[model samples]
Target: MTSSFAPDSLVLNRKLPLWYQVSQSLRASILGRSPDASLRLPTEEQLAGHFGVSVLTMRQALKELEEEGLITRHRRRGTFIDPAARRASPVRLLGSIDAIVAQQSGEHTTILGHGPEPVPGDLAAYFPQCPQVVTYRRLRRDGENGEPTNWAHNTVRPEVAERIDLADLERWPMTKVLRDAVGVDIGRITDTVEARLADPVTAELLQVPLLSPILHYTGIAYDGAGQVVDVARIHYRGDRFAFSVTVEAR
Candidate 1:
């Protein structure tokens, strides 16, 4: 039988393999039904019986859905649909360093490497026509002598270059330097996040085995006229960092 999955279309359920068919059915539910943003999803056995599939096959389909970021599973709790995006726009802001750092109960930092480097083409694509960019690459440690938690690569416009001093960065974040020394008011920002296996360089820096998972967060800050003032990538230590969001109606 032909696969019945439709990207955004609902299913009427005809003749199809139970697991393959259920995958499509759930996809439709995620897009159309708009399940409660905070509600946990039903159990695997429950889902298997609900759709007439063996538990093992049901699991395979669920794994596929999780890779698509359609759902998440906790240790003991059942699987849950990812309702953050459908419920509301994700949180995009400039106060991330303070917002995250402050939440830690103890001192959680040790900055390593801060200097000027030409921004990558992918990141440069986000900027307005500009010559030369300065970027700060800091290896942040989460605790005193803790494993390196992230490689924070921050790229900024030339105008903001003077604010960064490698000699003093061991003491402060470049975000603060932009406001305190460079005189630019950070009014808006945007962040995009993804979870993936660590690349070779990141694997070594994070002290993780090859193919170990990592959370990557990329972000950009813009000027009032929509010029891209900064682009940054943060590779967070997965075991230590928890990326979460809350959704509400607009």
Candidate 2:
């Protein structure tokens, strides 16, 4: 049977490892579909062709999916989507600032530590002219199962942080706290997303294996007057999250 997989939809990023990119694309497509035990995926050769990758690369991608329990392969029987895939419940990482804020509002949050600290040298560009920033570290878990999903480290201007109620951090996303409580006029937000290997600290906090692939997000929030207000560095467990984007043809 011919598979309905769309080759055009799979855009390859040459910078990243081919197998990893293909696997992530396939993972997203598979999860986006309705869970069907009888659904058969395209053959390895066909999928490789669709993704414009070598069969070996496709196999590697498929192997990763199998390890994650998202699919099962059988000799001479083709591959089928795992019925349990629905239970995986990967977070759909959206692009919009508002969407990003709304996505985390529903998650269960645990504050790890928050206090005044010097901004990291790497992030100094974002918080120009500021010697110190209020650092907030938090771990977010799935509301249903309490599974750790993301760890976020936020650095805010001391002045802005002072106006925010520490208690509110446990309940609302920082964007909301800054706007509503601190009265910062958020003019724009910039987000950069990338894939990185989990460091030792991140692995222990998120309870994932060291060096496992994870989603790294760096976000900068600017005030209406164009002053930077907050910089957030967040790491999401790869197995529990998938980044997605929507584009419209003008």
Candidate 3:
């Protein structure tokens, strides 16, 4: 018997396998549905019955949906659309470093390296009495294409550093990580943006040519009681991002 599953237009091919076709159709439906509508989808058995396929086929389609981050299947709670999937938009300056990262929920981060390092003379002004810190470097990439978009270097006090794990950095921003690890509440974040040509190491990490234009960011974050929590230097591909600000009339 011919497969009854409707073709998912997003896939751009009608002759694909039955499971692939059904998954495309279901994904398109969930994404196009109203934001307020029920985010859940039908059970595997019901879906299979509707498509004249076995439950295994339906499960295979659902697995694709889960892997694409379009929908999530709970052990007993059924499958539901991922809210973050729909909400991800191009990165924009909302507020704070953490806010910027959180806004683009679609991007993925990889920790390139992490280790303790001596505080630089310039950065030491922010930390004052602290002599050493731990540094963590990360590469942020496009979720769909896996293209490297930005790189960040984060430095924190040893106490706060000890509390952070490579896994924690993967899921949360360094700012939030500090708060969760040591109860550090950030009070102010100072940012300085500049334009510069990429260095050899940066070009390699960002996959851009040496001397490519780059946006350089230097940020210092302070805690509620005016203690330094962390400092960061972030480099973003110049073509991939824009900064926005607002000013009031004098």
Candidate 4:
């Protein structure tokens, strides 16, 4: 490994179970010593070699780590370290800054952007024919270095923007802006979540290895009228996010 390895934290002489010892050492390297919070976890094969163990044994240790909420695995991407900032969710996250922030505590806000790109055909299905609104994109992260954690892209109708000041958004979250400015109280939301491979652009921005997996969410927002008003698509670093939801079984 690079100079980021915390070799001092590792003790080859430890009497702990082999798997346990190897797991702790790997965790320390991935989370403790990496220069960047966005650094991706090493491949399992690499870990196995580092510990001089069979891949199966290395996997067992990684499995335990995943169960402990320390790492997440993506279909196309390998395992990743989940950031500890997100709090539990109130309901299914349908892709809103407030909803995401409810599961997190830190400075969060949207940056106003100028763009009226025609809504993609896939996303257009979520809204009716109308004047496409200006969209906003925000990259959110916490702690020192401002390591970008996730990118949130939101499309809002002109009516909503007309009543809200873009300047205020830089300081306050989108929900607070809507509720306080436009008198819209968000009651609930619905969304679809999926695992996706990182395109070259996303990987570069996130400082993650290209081809790594990222969490993808695409959905629409409905006001009290139950009419969809906005459509959003967001991608998050898979290694930096772990999702847990409670579902009822009938």
TM per candidate comes to 0.55, 0.72, 0.59, 0.58
lDDT of 4 by residue, 39-109 (tens): 45667887787777788888988887787677798867877767662422222453465664354233554
The numbered model that scores best in TM-score is 2
Q: Which has the better lDDT: candidate 1, or candidate 2?
A: 2
RMSD of 1: 10.3
lDDT by residue (147-234, candidate 2, tens digit) is 7888889999998988988789888889888988788899988887897878999999989766666889887899999989998888
On lDDT, who's better, 2 or 3?
A: 2
Candidate 3 wrongly placed segments (more than 4 Å)? 1-106, 248-250
Highest lDDT model number: 2
List the pairs of residues colliding in candidate 1.
Answer: none
Q: Would you list the C-alpha lDDT of every candidate in the order shown?
A: 0.61, 0.79, 0.71, 0.61
Question: Residue 21: error of model 2 in Å?
Answer: 11
- State the RMSD for candidate 2: 4.8
Q: How do the residues 164-210 of candidate 3 rate in per-residue lDDT, one tens digit apiece?
A: 77787787667667666557777887777786768998999998656
lDDT of 1 at 4: 27
Please give the lDDT score at residue 213 for candidate 4. Answer: 54
Global CA lDDT of candidate 2, please? 0.79
In the range 1-250, model 1's lDDT, one tens digit per residue, is 2232222333334554555556755654554433323345568887777666689978987887788787888888778767652431122233555653232222344455556666567765775476577777777675668757677777888776775566545555555555555666666667677866678988888886554456788766666667777776778665455456655555
